[model samples]
Target: MLFNIFISDLDIGIKCTLMKFADDTKLSEAVDTTEGRATLQEDLDSLEEWANKNLLKFNKTSSSSVERDLEVLVDNKLHVSEQCTAVARKANRMLGCIKDTTSRAKVITPLYSVLVRPHLESCV
Candidate 1:
């Protein structure tokens, strides 16, 4: 049981993620389900023996991720996602600038019309 606790903790990283030990009583029960705490200690001792024999084999493979083996395939996908977000933000800003430019042009058009109106009146 103690070995299972150690294995679960090592494999899962966070004790909060262990569903089997959701509460204090569950954790206590898992640590020493047998006769006594000494039995749990003895189980840990045997686990050490087994690990020493086969631990090198386990360390050869990654304990973290499988994506590293497929890095080339995954890189373009991640790049595309980042590029899309950058382009979307740039497009949003571009549209805002275009709208503001159009609005200012509209305001200037009426002023231009007013100045031309008097000049045309005098020429006519």
Candidate 2:
């Protein structure tokens, strides 16, 4: 018999869904506590077992790349990727706006709408 693995958050009483696109699989959950972390770890272990049983293996390099990103987020407290920062700096400079200088309302509004709005909106 074949079955898909499902993860549940016992504390919040919600089930975590796994998303897959082609060969890419994503597992996400709101992990803010010890129990949540343990639950996620358990789910990962189960996934590894299931993959091995089905003759499927995760890409090691991709897994490590994701781990590095997670480490950066945890250590920095901000999900500021290289591309995002570059775009933000470019946006600020495009309209002759300094980082800390107070600019006129008209200039600031358009600068934000054109350059910064897309990056902020993309996160959501």
**Candidate 1 worst ten-residue window by lDDT:** 65-74
In Å, residue 124's CA in model 1 sits off its true spot by 57
> Could you tell me how far off, in angstroms, the CA of residue 68 lies in candidate 1 after the best superposition?
18
Q: What does the lDDT read for residue 56 in candidate 2?
A: 72
Q: Rate the local accuracy (lDDT) of all candidates.
A: 0.41, 0.55
lDDT of 1 at 83: 39
lDDT of 1 by residue, 7-97 (tens): 5533222222223433211112144444556554554445445457546222434343222222221232333343344445555565555
Q: What clash count goes with each model?
A: 0, 0
- Model 2 is weakest, by summed lDDT over 10 consecutive residues, at 1-10
lDDT comparing candidate 2 with the true structure: 0.55
